[model samples]
Target: MTINCLDLFAGSGGFTLGLKEAGIKTKAAIEIDRFAVETFRHNFPKVDMHHRDITSFNDKEIKSNFTGVDLIVGGPPCQGFSVAGPSQYGKLDDRNNLVLEYLRFVKVISPNMVIMENVKNFINGKLPSKDKVIDVVTNILDKLGYDIKIEVLYAPKFGVPQSRTRVFVIAIKRGCGLPFPEIHETHGPDKKNYITVGEAITDLPFISSSAGYDDSPDKLTYNEIELSTYQKMMRKDGKGIYNHISMKHTPRLIERFKHIPLGGSLLDVPLEHGQRARNGTDLDTKARFKMNNQRLDPSKISHCVTASFQSTFVHPVMNRNLTAREGARLQSFPDKFIFKGPRTLMSKSLLIRENREHEIGLSQYNQIGNSVPPLLAKAIGSAIVKSFKHKVNDTRRATHEFA
Candidate 1:
């Protein structure tokens, strides 16, 4: 029997991609964003796609359209619940209701397993009513005959090169006992498996700061055609890697990047801001560094690859920031998995640093940054599959325990 699934708020299909890798095929995906939907269709062509907002999407259609969904894999739009976006006391709106929509489908479909991913803080995040979202979800899942299990997994520890932390809430049918997903740890603090930024991108061609979109293959700087096991797996059947380009940085931003050292944070820039702020040639400015921004540390695991990472993370050796593809690589997306949309996913936030500009939706960077690393997804998917065929013993014991 095939384990069918549905991906909700399927941003660029990252969760779905990993679920597919682990034998769970998506019956259909619902995404409102045009750019993300295009990328999803381009990659997973056969599956049904819906561009309607989930809130307004007729709930009855879910049952009428599909059945026997062993799993429902996806999270509601998290911008409202995210600690980075807004405080619980503020910004309450319809977006928060999307999670309720997710539950509505769950109530109807009653999938055997439901896996939801969200920002780590979502576990305890609250709505304006002062009701904890996690508590509400736990209550709902319990009443729905699901045994709830929650774990916050860090990407770096689970084969991803970057240090992004996400919360995975797994609920299995009540008869299954606790649903513990097996973890495939590729890197860790003690284990050398933690992939470094350099190891992740060393093989890709060096891109200049002014680099634009290119549809050709990147020139390899290193010899020996044999790729690292990580590279070989990620490069499988990849053709002209699309969306591997750089976002145009302002001249002032370039000057800012010059003063920041590798792996430093925003607090790393030079202190001399007023005098000769625009000039890079000033001796005082050149020497007066006070920690400007975060550049990738090639030797160590990368920090979180966020939509604004390019604005902050400078290349370890190179003077420029990571291109879209390099950012994708850091997120552990294979080369074959192409990202299609505007070359840059610019939003109102960019206006803070850039001129007035606009786009239909997310760029490759946002898609990648916002995605659950496929490696992490694959691990979770594989574990879920295993629970069906074997005892729940496949569970990886807690490495770094968090309540």
Candidate 2:
């Protein structure tokens, strides 16, 4: 009755951790990012990790390596399908095609259940082959004899502090008589009130932008601040905090943060310190984006934590941005989940220009930002586990009647 999983495109093992929490075992994981692989390895040392491009694996190699996997779970890279990206690229962005690679693995592994997660826009996004991405994926799953269910889940409803919405495609093999699993909301107006940003992270010790270390021997212990129920849960297994280092910011940027209020963004900053035009001139436009250097409101849930969140979000009370540890907390990563690799990486253009693209990998911030919130993943995993139990019970009843 144990459920075994194969994680494809597993970024920092978020999905795997959630499945583990739900009593499912992840037998193996595949990831292309080296830093992500490092973080995954550090946390899940026992899980087999294939640190290579998923596309490079031939069908024979996949079948030979991964057999008897009861479930397959992953979040194919979503930059191309994300609405946050350039609209002109649309389906043409090469990353969008990775979904096909994900499907290829599923075909080879022949798992009983498959769960794929992506940005909410992915549900309607089109593939480069002029087909709706969802349609193409579901069509293949149908032909492969699997019933599919698609839904856009709001993270906060599942106990994550951030308002992240993602599309989940759940496929169950035909004849299981198992419908899509129903994951009930644990946090909302009707249930418990959504966890606030403060509740998620206030227990951690505060550090300034100029303070803290990437990998110090010194582990920070809990301060005297009262811990919230969520914080208590995060620290349940953690002895001390690591990877809580803050990013160094320029004095000018620090000054700008002073003018911004909680829940404010770029629009809140004065023209003198506002976002500059490409040519370094001040633009008089009042355009504002919720993601631009957003100062979180401690009383409410946070805005979406994107991969570039190190620079996108300002700390609620501090003038500097959130540390990798703080971002992890908002994503519902427990305090014990230590992130590995550089605290922050150079921009892609800068790295490419410097010819160091291969030398450097995803930063800790990038790994945390790109991860699925563990709590939300746990909800999905629990639902699937429930379905498996139901199937077992039904089989038992049938066998008893026949006897």
Candidate 3:
């Protein structure tokens, strides 16, 4: 029997992509953003998409959508729980409380297994200590008689090119007693090397920031490559890769990139160029150096890929920041998974363009930044499916003995 899943806060279906890869069928997904909904449909046309606010989601409606889901996978919105975003007290209306909505569904649907992902700050943040979150979550699951396991996983360790750290909680129905998912150590003394930025993007051709050329809407073009290994692997299939959103750079941003050396930051540029450098620590400054290239430190891996263009995500080799496609590649989204919607349509577009004056899809870029790497999602999906199957097996054995 096919393992089925109900995905919550399913942004662009990154979690769904992984679940599908791990052999679980996504029966339905709930998301609020119209852009994310469009992107999800571009990839998963058949998934039952509920574009309603997660807070308004109905448990009975969800339960009626599927008979018995083997797994539930999702992340509640993380702004309130995120240390990076504005840290509001856990208010009743705070988006962070959507975790309760997730719990409500768990109570109603009672899936055999549940998998959750969120920013690492969810565990380390001060407002809601990790313990508090776990206690509440575990209590709910415990009431339903399930054993839970939680961990903070780093994505690069799982073959994703970028360094993304997230808190993951996995639970299996008790009495079945399934073990937690094994960590796939792909890098270091124990295994092969962790995925690298160079390994992820060596295939695309180079495009200068000033160039006003556009490829056919169907066939996308890659602008840079450091090596052929990553490039060749990404292009293994002829269908061409997806999620290739490149932004146009302003004259000043382009000049700043030109002056900044490889692995150097905006601070590295001379003061003559109207920029300043940090004295000791990384404060929010345009003058700070951006670590654009992926360095080969076997002990430490790459930095987390974020959606903000102004952040320190510049190309290691190129003069400007890493484009949306480059960021997506680092996150291990397949080549065919294209993103929709223009970047400048969001509320923050004016501020972004005023500061940088770039004509790229800023909102869509942020979505990609906020998304869970689909490859990592697949790993979580696989683990959840395995745990669910183990529970079903135990159930069958108990029934047979009674018979």
Candidate 4:
């Protein structure tokens, strides 16, 4: 039996890939950004795609492409609730409204199962108004007649090389008797079990942070052997070396990078110009890192790779921010899964985000950073499939009784 799925708010098919890994076929996907939509089409050439505001996406048209969608899965952008982000839209930003849009489709499609993902803070987080986001979500999903199970899944616990934590809400139709996915602990709580940043990207070619974008989607091997089990898994069934381009940084930035040691911080680097200060000179006048941590420890799992990692995270060894390719490896995306869109913009400032009216469009870096780690997704998918097997057995026994 084929399990059909629709990826709502599908940003370059991250959740879709997870479903595919779980033996599900993605029937269609909807994304708002022009760049994300283009990348999704490039990767999943045969899959149907809709590009535009999903609120305006008509169900009548969707019905023509697919019938009886078994699952609808997506992670509505949660920047407003993201602990790493501003965290208080105080009022619904256009992005936050996508949560309602997600529920809208769930009500329409009424899939046997629905999976929604968001930042870890989403559970207790509030929208800009009186109603809590969680309360609104649970109430609406309950009204739609689905039983819900919510969990805050940590990425590394399920084989991702990073320590990203996100909330997943799984809704199985009433009386389905399906439990939430069985959690797996692949790597955690021990030095040997954890995947380090070096282990994840060691097999890829070393590129300078100050390099320009490369258009070719050809694989470039690092001339080194794939040593880690994690590396082997990502490289498995992969043929292309795509989206490895580095940000084109300036001479001063390059000089700053050189000064930082392995796992050193951009914040700690001495500045070229500013009001002189004792700690590396003119620290206050310089660009603030605003990083959760100033440096990445090469020997350990990485900090979350946000869209702004270009300026925020220092390479464990290289004198640059992690390349898009390196970040993908850390995110457990196979080498074949190349990111498409502008590699790096002239500026990645916070201005556009502050303007509540505008959405922060995804860049290649953003696409990879914002994705669910494919390994973690695979684990979840595998568990879901396991539950479905039980569901199938239950149906068979019930049918036999009826007969």
- CA lDDT, every model vs. true structure: 0.75, 0.87, 0.66, 0.75
Give the TM-scores of the predictions, in the order they appear: 0.85, 0.96, 0.81, 0.88
lDDT of 3 at 285: 50
lDDT of 4 by residue, 8-71 (tens): 8888887878778888888988888877887789889988888878877677855665577888
**Which pairs of residues have clashing backbones in candidate 4?**
90-128, 91-128, 219-241
As a TM-score, model 2 comes out at: 0.96
lDDT value for model 4: 0.75
lDDT per residue, candidate 3, 108-182, as tens digits? 888777887888767644323334565677788889877878788878767777667889887777655566666
For model 3, the stretches where C-alpha displacement exceeds 4 angstroms are: 88-93, 126-131, 176-179, 188-192, 210-233, 236-238, 241-245, 274-301, 309-311, 344-362, 389-403
Better of 2 and 4 by lDDT: 2
Best by lDDT: 2
Model 4, poorest ten-residue lDDT window?
A: 285-294
Candidates ranked, most accurate by lDDT first: 2, 4, 1, 3
Best by TM-score: 2
Give the alpha carbon lDDT tens digit for every residue of 1-403 in model 1: 3668888888898888887898878899888888788889999998888887887757688888767777888877777777667655576645666777898888888888888888887876776566888898889999998888888888887788887888888888876544466666656567477888877877776666776454655532322355777777777888745565666667766776676677674456565421243655433544543333567788888878776565646777666777777888888888888887775655666764676544447766777777888889988888877776553342333322431
Residue 23, model 4: Cα distance from true site in angstroms: 0.8
Residue 343 miss distance in model 1 (angstroms): 2.2
